[model samples]
Target chain A: SQTIHQWPATLVQPVGSPLSLECTVEGTSNPNLYWYRQAAGRGLQLLFYSVGIGQISSEVPQNLSASRPQDRQFILSSKKLLLSDSGFYLCAWSRGNTNTEAFFGQGTRLTVV
Target chain B: AQTVTQSQPEMSVQEAETVTLSCTYDTSESDYYLFWYKQPPSRQMILVIRQEAYKQQNATENRFSVNFQKAAKSFSLKISDSQLGDAAMYFCALGETSGSRLTFGEGTQLTVNP
Candidate 1:
């Protein structure tokens, strides 16, 4: 059974927040990890994806960045946050090969005050 | 770049009735995959159904089914016997055969009326 873990289900940070959101997968090795953001009542936007350790491909360039420290661990970070940065963040993983079925975590709802 | 479009921003269906959500995509790749995801108010997204471009047969999961038109670049989801639990934001996504990155549409919100 594969499971994904994301911390701080809900978070509140100031306008200039240095953010660090962690996502880790269990029961799987060398899986593809991704970070996505969804606004209020809006669709999801892919932020970043990692195929392997230290290999991150950014989809959207913004005030955020992603890094893959371990095979199944992905982290989303920001040096500072803007009001527009407040949204629902999701972490997902899939088999790296041609298997495209994705498994998503519960998600993190961040509010910038 | 590949893109997906959902014409209806929102829709409503009576319980026990059927509803169809339209989704069209633009892609030059002949090998790809289509998917439908459901997101409740809780905001957790779950895969509803998937269709492979190579397969002509429609995919179904209980009350959920898809009409995949390869030539027209269209993939629509049909939900039968709609239930309260079926009320959620539905998203149409496309994944290229060579890569696993998914391109998602804006989404269509479905409301189940009792």
Candidate 2:
């Protein structure tokens, strides 16, 4: 079975601070990875997706960035966080091929004050 | 660019009753996929059902099923004998044939009344 793990289930960051969220997948290799953010009572917003290591596509321009440092390890980072950056961050993995359902991680909730 | 639409912002159903959430999408590609995801209070995005564009038969999983109308570009989810745990926000998503990215709808919150 495939599973995804995300760290710092919850975080409280001050404005203008650096941000780093990690997501790792097990039981799968070369899977597609994606980063999404959801505000309270809002829909999931696609931030970035990666097909392979060092390859990423940004869907919406924002204060966040994503990286695939390893085959199953994805990281979301920001040099400086903004108030608008506060939201629930989710990591998802798919079979790389199209038309495949995506599996999501536990998710990280970031609160900026 | 493909777009997903969930016309219903919220819906309510009695326990043990059947409820259907509506979803529609717009896409120019002949080959694509539609999906319904459930987000409970915990906020975990769980796949409920999926429908392939080329398939004629709708997809079903246990108590959940989807009505896939390829020509109408409509994909609706039906939950039979709704349970208390079924109270959550449902989202409709669209994925293109060439990309792995998914475009999500605004979501419809389903409330199960006792």
Residues A1-111 of candidate 1: C-alpha lDDT, one tens digit per residue: 999999879999999979999999999898989999998788889999988999999998899999998999999999999999999999999888875778899999999
User: How far is A44's C-alpha from truth in model 2 (Å)?
Assistant: 0.7
lDDT over C-alpha atoms for residue A83 of model 1: 92
Worst 10 residues of 2 chain B by lDDT: B94-103
lDDT of 2 by residue, B1-114 (tens): 788889899999999999999998998899988899999998889999988899999999999999999989999999999999999999999988788888999999999999
Which parts of model 1 have CA positions greater than 4 angstroms off? none
Candidate 1 structure quality by residue, lDDT tens digits, B6-35? 999999999999999999999989888899
User: Residue-wise lDDT of candidate 2 within A1-113, one digit each (tens)?
Assistant: 89999988999999999999999999988999999999888888999999999999999998888899899999999999999999999999999765588899989999999
Query: Where is model 1 chain A poorest over a 10-residue stretch in terms of lDDT?
Result: A94-103
What DockQ does each candidate score versus the true complex, computed on alpha carbons? 0.70, 0.77
lDDT of 1: 0.93
TM-scores of all candidate predictions against the true structure: 0.98, 0.98
